[model samples]
Target: MTIQTNICPRCGKPTEEGLCPQCRAADTKLLACEPRVTAVYCPVCDSQKRGKTWSDLRMPREDLIAELAVSAVSIHEDAKNLKVAVRSEDTASNRTACTVEVEGTLYSVPVSETCEVEILWQKEACDRCSRISGGYYEGIVQVRATDRKINAYEREVAASIAEQAEESLQQSGDRLSFISELEDSKDGVDITVGSQHLGQEIARMVTGALGGRYTTHPKLVGEKDGKALYRVTYSIRLPFYQKGDVVVSRGGYFEVREIDGRRLRVFDLQTGATRTLAETEVERLLGNVRDAESALVVFTQPNMVGLMDPKTYRTRELSAVPWTFPVEGQPIRVLRDEEQDRLVIVG
Candidate 1:
């Protein structure tokens, strides 16, 4: 087989290099220079524009390097299987310089190039952050207790619910999903949300978990482009009696076991039966047993038991169910119903 070659113009010789070895070497040296790119980012938000949408600033440093690496280098159309890598990084006072290496095949020839890219960050507030600083709010959620003052534990729970809801909604691309402010008041908790939909969502979630009822009221706040705009107020009312509280309603003594929506599951002290009561029926709360001590069970009977009260240190006969009897000398819960003038044995 005869080897094919090209005639060099300057050297006047048949050679495979075409332009001769000297010219070919010079061309290769010129081709191995560098790439070209310009990367811009927001200094305030630390976010970069990826297509039309902005990327999350919370991404790690390595992820940012990988993202900028591809778009920073300009590859020729003849190059195939192009790959980019970050070789080194230099961080200055306000700007960051990254040496990006690009490797690919140009016309079936392996070639590599590196370029230094400076990430220029400009100061600008993102849409969400700007709106938040502008005190933009679409709705207010007011948390209150029904026929009682809000407790600290319940207030904390409501606040946590609002925070979790805001985070979840923000991740779903709702840029306006945020809690602008959380205020603890005598009534309960007030959460200011960036969107009326988010306010309602958080209110519902808190009420569902803590057993309460909520209602929405719209108020005309302003006008936008000849259209009237209204802000919503979500009023959430928690249950009057929480679990483990002794309450009296309609001349009946009962202990609240569970609360669901506007209804409550309670155990009747008189009949030793479990039943549910509507919110409207729970007229008033007589008292709350913050704590109860185990009393000494002196005598055990089928229908009644004699218990020595821990507070009073006196033996009292309290009614008990046939199956709910405590053993003699064992401890039992003896609750005193001051209004009913009787002792309740809740074992």
Candidate 2:
């Protein structure tokens, strides 16, 4: 068999293929170099911009460089049936680069080449971080009590729920959701949120977790784009009496067991019966269990149970409730009513 040869059109050289060896090499060299990849990053917050939203970095820097490098690679238009893969990627503090191996058929001939992708990381502040630095907030969440001051427990719960909500929202790709500041004051605990919707969400979460009500008040701050833009304020009000608190109402002392919606389930210290009080009727709080103490039972009679006060060491007889049948030497909680000069059974 004899090898067939053809003259290249441009180079006018005899070759076994369509183009001469020199022409093929020249054409292959015409393939453009890899374009520079750019990544907008917020160094302060460690966030990367994905499309229009700024998101926290989900992958390691090297892996991110590999992905971005592959995407930024531009194959020559003449090179059909192209395939490229990242062979290796290296990243530094402010820069990332990757080596990609490309293989494809160009003009009915197999062509292979390697390209370097350099990702220039531009350090800048994200939109949310910039606004936060400026003290910008679209809404405020004020945690308060319906009938009394906010307790330490309630404040902690509300703040924790708000923080968790922020994390949840951010992980869901909500770039605008952010908490600007959390302030504790004499009035109440205030949470400043970057977005109005986030503020509303935090208020709902606090109310839902702690069992309370919320009211939203929108104040017209200004107009934007021919529309009214109002800043919102969410007032989250907790119940007047939390569970395990001792309250005095209608000359009767009770220990709050549960706040079931519209009713308060309490252990009536006066009658030793579990009773329900309309939450609306809880006008004031007299005292709590902080002053109560456990007393040791000395003996029991038909109507009264004798007990020794741990503090005063004084022996006293108190009317026993039907619900409680104290055994000898059993300890029971009692509240001292100094005005009445008597000890009241609590629980």
Candidate 3:
């Protein structure tokens, strides 16, 4: 005798696919979901977020979502913790589950399928107190993104920080080098030198008689005490240029011996020796720029914007919003129709 079987017309299954018998009467639920390959977004700026779902990329939709019971989490594997990795270039959140933003749009980067190392760029997100409006990046907030690997990110960060350190020391060196033309220090503690060329200022100073920027393959940690009580020897990293050019003039030249407010020194090409100069004299000659200053923008006060003049060292205020960002649902007193949709940081 031949056996017969009964199956649901909808699913064409006698059983295992979860058809017929006890499963047809449930409510029909619909949601917005689609399989995406490359997704990028930051949750802090997302209008809405997708609820947690099982990350089974390869599964039949119906069979993939058959919930026996509504539970907190439904992953089949309980012991395997997901691993996430991010690269140095990526400065956004480095999480197994992330709220990442890329170029001001919201999408989730599926880290489960992502790699051991990924190359990403720095975009908008460090300052959190802001919003996204229309297509333009409407808010002025900053955030940091980073990778999962500890060492690579550390190296990148270290390079940047080291650059900043070099630049700062150069600025100080410029001032001291100028003073070396006039007065020398007494304790040698007042003068300072730099380990490498952080920027043009240091290069110009150190290249003294053989003037201009020089690129010396610097050791990672620079040198210490050869002239001043706190003499410095530092490793320098530069561009394609090797052994940065040095210049000589009628009066003298300069080279870095140490970098310390506690102590300082500058080289005199004419004297062909290191000298101790007052930090004050260094300022009068080379230009004493504050460490917080930027090569691009000058500031009258902290948080104020504007490009300050390099010569006079004077600053003017940057533009300000005549009308600030509007409060959602609040009435905006219209002073002028011209200012509508203008730039203001609204909440």
Top of the candidates by lDDT: 2
- Ranking the candidates on lDDT from highest down gives 2, 1, 3
Better of 1 and 2 by TM-score: 1
The window of 10 residues in a row where model 2 has the poorest summed lDDT is 25-34
Q: Which residue pairs in candidate 2 have backbone atoms (N, alpha carbon, C) closer than 3 angstroms, thus clashing? A: none
For residues 17-84, write the lDDT of model 1, one tens digit per residue: 56765444335521232243344455655765555565554777777665665556555666677777
**What tens-digit string does per-residue lDDT give for candidate 3 at 72-111?**
1222232133332222232444322212111211112121
lDDT of 2 by residue, 1-347 (tens): 23565778888777776887567856665244566878888888889887777878578866777788888766777777777777554467766667788888776677888877788888889998999999888999999887678877778888898899899888887877899989988777999999987998999988776667889999998988999988899988887777667777787877887776678998887677788998666655646675578999999999999989877899999988877878888888777777677777765
Give the number of the best model, judged by TM-score: 1
Off by over 4 Å in 2: 1-33, 74-93, 102-112, 246-262, 267-275, 279-347
- Candidate 2 yields a Cα-based lDDT of 0.80
- Between prediction 1 and prediction 2, the one with superior lDDT is 2
TM-score to true structure, per model: 0.69, 0.66, 0.17
Q: Candidate 1's error at 32, in angstroms?
A: 12
| Local distance difference test, each candidate | 0.74, 0.80, 0.27
